[model samples]
Each structure stands twice: as structure tokens, then as C-alpha cells.
Target: MRIPTVLLLACIPATAFAQQAQPETGSEWEVSSGVEYESGDYGTGTGTDIEILSVPSRLGMTIGRVQMIAAIPYHRIEGPSDVIPGNVLGLPLLPQPQPEADSVTRNGWGDLELGATYALPVKAVNFSLSGSIKLPTAENDLGTGETDYTIGAEVSKAISDKIIPFASFSYTLPGSPEGISLQDRYAVTGGMATWLGRKTQLSASYRYGENPDAAVTDDQRVQLGLNQWVGSGLSIGVYGSAGLSKGAPDQSVGLRIGFALD
Candidate 1:
């Protein structure tokens, strides 16, 4: 089955933190778009392989210390129909692999996510509390077909104006289809970012998450990213991740471009 896709790295708060020490205050707006590809064999030596291609776009605005964001993602899946269900977002929590003869391919819009984050300075650290909801806007089987909620907090501190360290923790409660009981899940992330020059930055992070399905293993991943300011409120970034556990994709890579509007 496909695993839960973690888009935390592409989210507004994470991007802002990587570019600066804290979230921007006052009034600002941003638009970003990116595409990602992931391919892996996930079926515990069953040779069940899947590939996913996704394009996610986001619009965000900051008012005072509050940041609001809206995102939509489109997904395409290719694999054996049994291993990768048609219309399912990526992979189901539990694998329901069918025979190799039932292979299928599907593509469609996924889900919509809306989120808000409130930030404040505490001593030398910038702290943010955020919450989000996922709307079941995709066609049946293309999404969970249920709403999901998440709450999280993040803290970051800068050292000597060149190095920044941050940590975040979040919990998610998912709503599943009838007869399916999905467990609550939690994730933790720790990372550091450093300025390479006046306008370039490099970062690395580790992420761990508890599996929502008892039958599957927990998730572990390591990510490396770079962001460069192209001048005049524009930035470009690239990122890659490798899975450290079976619950995550074997490898993923993506590119993003963002623009700021005052």
C-alpha cells in the first residue's frame, strides 16, 4: 500500500523558517508551486512497487503574527491495481494487493488543505502554534473520503546569525471509510539550517512518525534542502529525501519556486 505523503517541508511555516529565523510579521502574501516524484517497493519483500507523481500549489498570506495558507495537490499513481488502489490518494494504510493481472493506472486531484499558524517570540526562540484541516474534495478513491485534522507546534532559534535550529511536533487524527478504524498518529521533526552566503541557504532534517496502521511499520526519513534568493522577493529551492524505514518511500525529490508580494 502507499504510505502517507508528508508535505511538511513544502508548507508555508517550514519554508519561512528555513529562509529566516522566524515567520514574517505585518502583511505579506506568497504563492508557491512544486512537483514531486517518489518511487519505491513497499510490500515487505512482495515485490510490489509503486510510483507517485504529485503537483502541489499553495497560496499564503500573513497578517500580523497569523499566517493562513490554502493548498491543493494533484496526484498520479501507476502500479499493480491490487498494490496501488485506483482513486486512492497514494497508498492505503493497509495493503489490499490484488493479483498482478489487475494492474491499473489512475490520476486525479487529491485533497485540499487549509491551515493557520500563529507565531510569537519567546526569549531567544520563535514559537508557532498551528492547526489545519483536510477537506475531502477529491473523487472517491482518490482521497480518504473523510476529513482530517492536525495540530502542531514549532520552535526555532538562531545562533550567531548564521546557524538556525528548529524542532516541531504534530498530531493527526484521520477519518476513515466505514468499517475502517484508523489510529491517531504523531510526527516529530528536528533540523538545522545555515546561511551559505548572503542569499543562499542549506538545511537538513530528520523526521519520524508513528504508523496509523498497526500492520505497517513506523515512518522515518532524512531530508536535505537548499534555498537561494534570486532577488526581488523571489526564491527557488530543491529538496531530496531518503526513507529510513519501510513506512516511507524509498526516495523522493522535488523543486519549488516562490514569490513574495507586499
Candidate 2:
């Protein structure tokens, strides 16, 4: 049976809302679109595969000292379970069996986030506010699933004209009562942005998060990208991410394209 949009959204839980997958560019009234893929194991057992094709748009304008910003993210995910050896095997000498991912399902548009940011007026230092929600708009066949409403805030500071740094943290109130995927979560990250020279800009950030109610799948994410300006409003980049932990995937790589307008 095809999953309903509302039910699919409901299946995606608080965990989606709590992850810091995107970075703040703080460009006034600019929009960008990109595709991302990530592979990681579930808990310390299941192999996990996730692919996201997101077209995120941000609009920010400076008002005297503060920069007010708004953003939205839309995407999907597909996950499969893992298999291991069973504990007791005697008749025919065998190892063991453990299944992490019990089943598999494709969650389409599992979640969406809408939020606004306010940047403080400081010559070299800036602060921002981010408010958003994650719709359970994807398939939830993975067993650990729930609906959720989330809110978050973060800030960024620039060390020089060509360099910027930022950090973020947030809390969520899950709607599902069945003790869904992961748990209420906490996230922390820091990154730097710099110009390679003339028209190239490079940005990278390292993100870490913990599952508050469960210790099964804590995460450590590292991301890097190189942007080259082709014309007045056109740009492209090679982007990738990898998980650095026991239950995480080895690597994930993708591409990005963006344009700007007056």
C-alpha cells in the first residue's frame, strides 16, 4: 500500500528534527538546491543507507544591525536492516546471528523544516535564531518511528572578511507515545568558511549528536565542500560527508548547484 502524506510525515520522528545536516550561509535573500547521501549502521548492528535530494531556500536581509533569515528543507530516506550470526549453533558448527535492521522501507519527504533566524549586529561577531518543524512525511517501516514537532537556535561569528564560524543546539517534543526512533536529542557543531583566493570559497563543519533516551546510535558527522563561482549568479561544488563512529558508514559523496537573483 502507498503511504499517505500525513502518515508518512508522522512516521518520521524527532530524530530528523534534531540533526544538524545543513549549515547557515547567511546570504541575504538567496536560494540554493543540493543533493546529499549518507550511509551508517543502525545502533551498533544494522547497516543503514540514506539518500536526500533537497532544495533548501534561505531568505535573509539586514535591518540596521540584525540579519533576519528564513529557511526550509525538504527530502526523503530509505533504510534496510542488517543480519548477523545466531548465538547458539551446534549441529553444523556456526558463528552467530544478529539482525539490526529488521526490515526496510522508503520514506518519501519524511520531514520538512521551516524557520527564521535573527543575526545580532556585531562588526565581527554575529548571533542567529532558528525555529522550525519536521513533518513525518516519509515511510517508517524501520520499527523505531514517531511523529514530532521541533524548535532550535544557533549563532555564527566571523573572524575576518573571508572567514566565518558557527555553533548550534536545540530541543524537541516528540508526538508519538510508542517510544519511537532514537530519542529527544542534543546537537553541537563548529565550522569555518574561507575564500580560496579569487572566486573559490570553501566551508566545512563537524557535527555531533546524542540520543537522550537511548545510547544506541550516537553520531559524529564531518562535512566538506568547495564552491566555485562561474558567473554573476551561478556556482557549483563537490560536497561529501562521512560518519566517524563505530555504528556509522564509511563515506557519502554528492554534488551541489546554486544560483542567485536580485
Candidate 3:
């Protein structure tokens, strides 16, 4: 099935809301909300302008070495046509022209995701394994309209009292749409984080992904982020990413707010 460009942009994993590599000490609940904005030209040589705005919220609970999270997102997409140049993989090739009337602006709930993670501490490093499912819950071509699954692993180590480095890899099994066949994709991430102060942290990461299908090239992106603890059990963060290849968005920005219930 041909994937929607908006879904590709919305689904690309970012570290904006990722959990710590190591499980927390005790049972805790976290609630988080965030918004993102992205705009780019994605239609082959047509220079078709595409803009996306997304608001996402997640609820998570952790106990010992296990964690579970549920998330929902709202999406608003504006573009020249419902059908874009590339398949679901967000590869910009050549634009197929539709009637001007076919262009539209649409907004709605995108998809629901449920995931679980487990962590193990070995010597000086933490190893984590996670799995997730994306449910089709969108309308107006806002989502893939199919269920997707992903499995991932991560490892992290603290080099110093304030610095931690990590690496992760994941594979996604794509769901088939009515008339299109989808292929599996994989991603890799490497990054480091350091404490700047008692209540502030800074991080940078690079991500690379194999194309989801034969229609697109692979994707590469770099992200920089800062998180600050504003009060007890509450924190806020901001992040930005720049695309390093044609398969990624040109640029994107986002903000997040989170609260933890101890």
C-alpha cells in the first residue's frame, strides 16, 4: 500500500519523549504532552509544499524493570494533494498531478500506540528491550490506516557522574494497505547526554533509517535537545532536528511538558 507522507513524518521516531534507558527505582506514573511543526518540499521535482502540525500526549507507568506507555496524536496536514509523489516511504520523486480540487487541508486524530519496555542492568551498563504496536485510528488520510509493529533494543553506560552515552536499534514491520505491499524498515540511533547543572540536561543524537519500501531512499537526521526540571516531578524540554538526506524532513521543531506522579 502507498503510505501517506504525513504519516511518515509523524511516525519518524525522535528522542523527544523517550524513556530512560534504565528502569526507575520504583513504580511511577508519567504524563506528557507535546507539539511539533514541520514543513518541507517533498514531491519529486514539483516542489509541492507540505506542512504538518502534530500534538501528541502519552501516559506511562513504570515498575521495577518494566515500563508501559500509551500515546495518541492529533495531526493537521496541508498539501497540494492527497496523493503525493512517493509511496508511504516519503520519498520525493516526481509529482503526479491531480485536479486542483483534490488539494486539501485536513486535521484529525492520527493513531494510537501502545508499547512496553524492560531493562536489565549488567555490570556498568543497562540494556533495554522494547516492543510497540501502532493502531489504525485516523481518518481523512491522516494515518497509514493499518496496524504496524516495532521491536527495539538499546544499551547505555555512564562514563562519568554527569555524562551518559547510548546506542539503539529497531526494526519495524509495516502493515499492508488495500492495494500496496509494504516492506520492513530498520533504524539506528547514537547519542550522548550530560548534566549541565543540578536541574538541567543537554543531549544530542543522530538517527539513520533504512527506507520502508523500494520507492524511497534511506533517511538521516540529527537532533539536539535540552531538558530542564522546573519543579518537583515536573519537567519541560525543547528539541529541533535537521534532515541530512532527501528521505527526511528539511527541519522540524517541538516542545514537551511532562509531570511524574511518584
Writing each residue's lDDT as its tens digit, candidate 3 over 1-262 gives 1111111113323222233323446777778888888766532333555677878878887776777788787877777645322222333222243333334677878678888877655555667688888887766666667788888887767777778777778888878776554578888888887779866777788988876645655778897777777777777778888888766778889887777777
Q: Write the per-residue lDDT of candidate 2 for residues 1-262, one digit (tens) a residue.
A: 1111111011111111111112234432334555555444434453433333434344444333233334343434444331211000000000122454444433333333344444343344444454555444333331123344545555555556666565666565544434333346666666765668656767677767664335455557787766667766566666666777643345666665555543
Model 3: lDDT of residue 203: 79
lDDT agreement with native, every candidate: 0.68, 0.42, 0.64
Worst 10 residues of 3 by lDDT: 1-10
- The Cα error of candidate 2 at residue 238, in Å, is 3.0
Candidate 2, lDDT over the whole model: 0.42
TM-score of each: 0.86, 0.64, 0.83
Model 3, CA-based lDDT: 0.64
Positional deviation of residue 12's Cα in model 1 after best superposition, in angstroms: 9.1
Candidate 1 TM-score versus the reference: 0.86
